[model samples]
Target: MTNKDKSHLCWTIAFSVGLLFSGRAAQATLPIELEVAMEPGSSLTAPQEWTRILGKMNLSRVRLRSIRSTDQPSVTHVQVGKSTRYRVLAILSHRDELILPKKHFRMQDRRKLQTYFEQLPNETQRNASPRGRFDLTEKQFRRLFTELSQPVSFATEGKISSEVLHQLQKKLTLPVVQTPRSSVLLELSLRGELQGLSTGTALAIVLRQHGLMLQPEITRDNSMQLTLATYDSQGDAWPVGWKPEKSIRLIAPQMFEQLTLEATNITFAEVLSQLKPRLKVPIVLDHWILTQREIVPDQISVKLARRKTFLKGALNRLASQARLATEIRIDELGQPFIWVTQFGKDSPRATQ
Candidate 1:
């Protein structure tokens, strides 16, 4: 018998003993009495089927309650004395009926389930997390945000949309899904390059060219995923990018720098093309607004009296006359640009 073997055995014994006692201590976390309210139209099976897993997770005395679908949110209204009770907002799994936040979890994997359950937030801090139509846990969303902020370069390289989609699937960490694969999105061979842009920003631009939008949704238990879907004017979708953290004045000083301007009988499009190089940022038109309003930039004339003003100031007057709005927004990578959109909406056209 070696002294080294004895030492290893002693450490293993200590760890086993510690884990056993810790599990016992964790047993009092919540009252055994809990209710699993099945929201209306939820595909989940009878709540009684959850008994075995709930028992394994130490939630034994769970009751079932059927609910009616309503415009109001489904929040459990239970009182557990002076202590706070967690309001969990969960979606049932379509395949195999396992609850999410339980990654690759099988009913037989009780030890792993117990370990994960034990690591959850303490009773007081376990509040419900919901935002917008699609929601991810706060911790999960933060992780997704951090990953999207990484800078990357992407080029179409004459590949069809389907090929491009496959390429994106390979490059991104999240699973990419394109539903009903549009003939245009699948067949159109796009040509463009987005260099030194955040992954999310680059993807949004690339997808826009195909008339599709990049939507991050909660599907997998471990991570939020990306979906390529047709743009919906009424639906809530992810933004093409975000407003820069830095002030607009600092990020695009060139656009704000004073310049003397005089234009007589020149079309707005001509002026924009001439000023594009000076702005040092891309000037993008909301195609939706232009197409819907039947606005042709070349046909709209601009006549400005000689004055000392910045590019954005002049642009504001021109956009206002055409019933358009100009906003400076940043991409996920913090690159500033001018976004021209329809005037009626208070927010950017790209966002909800």
Candidate 2:
């Protein structure tokens, strides 16, 4: 062989030998055991302590290839690729107990695994990674390994591996509500009105509000339940003091339902504000809305002239209220006016 070819072959041989030794070392970490103290409803206490132990194990040079969470409460299983045919590490209990079979794992294997997690695509390795930042979590990582010997995926049918579920849970931010019950739990939220009205009435009101006349097809009661936010315990903003502008008749069942629907979905604040448009103190009103509908959409052309008139009018009104002398100047639209002060001796000067 040529000199270059020989050198390349030597380098390949050295790399392969190094990898073999590395795998052997990683395989040495296995068969770990842990004892956990259970808290009612809570998986485990002292999770932070377990994290610290994991940090230390990583420092000791142990390498972990995969990790998985178990159905057993307060338990996580870790796999060391080359440790043994059945090589696994278990973390358990609220007490954060760390145990292992003799000669199962060397600290070096843990260290290598920690390094691997730190370099992952998502920042799942960090304990304090904020929600919504990454697509996965540490809990999911452990569950991923316990299933298939392959990578995580959703296509697999029939009983899904716990790992895939964990990843999906992370991605969707599904609240993990574990009761004393043995099976997994899930919850969904409903968004319209429910508490404010009866089922039939609520449906009718929603239809009316949406500008749709109530029909038999839509007359049926909605199965969805609306969840309301709890008010502050102090009762500073209680609803007792509210003064609604208009009250609609609710004599019939359908009418009762419609009123309730409007009550819950319609904001009192927004409705009140809309009713008193002049309350904005500086609304840009157009004489056109009262006179011409056709030219209303083209408000942009009159905007600057209208704005000048608005300001002048405001100043004139303010001067009259404050009992101050003022002369006003306005542009095209009879709106805002510019305020000018006439001196006893000199020319009148405009006050901008």
Who wins the lDDT comparison? 1
For candidate 2, the lDDT comes to 0.27
lDDT for 135 in candidate 2 is 24
- Model 1: which ten-residue window has the lowest total lDDT? 66-75
lDDT of 2 by residue, 67-116 (tens): 23442322233446853122224433223333332222223356544443
**CA lDDT, every model vs. true structure:** 0.59, 0.27
| Residue-wise C-alpha lDDT for candidate 1, range 78-194, written one tens digit per residue | 566875443433322323343434354445666775665454433223334544344556676677767777765566546676765565556668777767755456677654445
Best by TM-score: 1
Give the C-alpha lDDT of model 1: 0.59
TM-score of each: 0.58, 0.15
Where is model 2 more than 4 Å wrong at Cα? Answer: 1-3, 22-352
Clashing pairs in 1: none
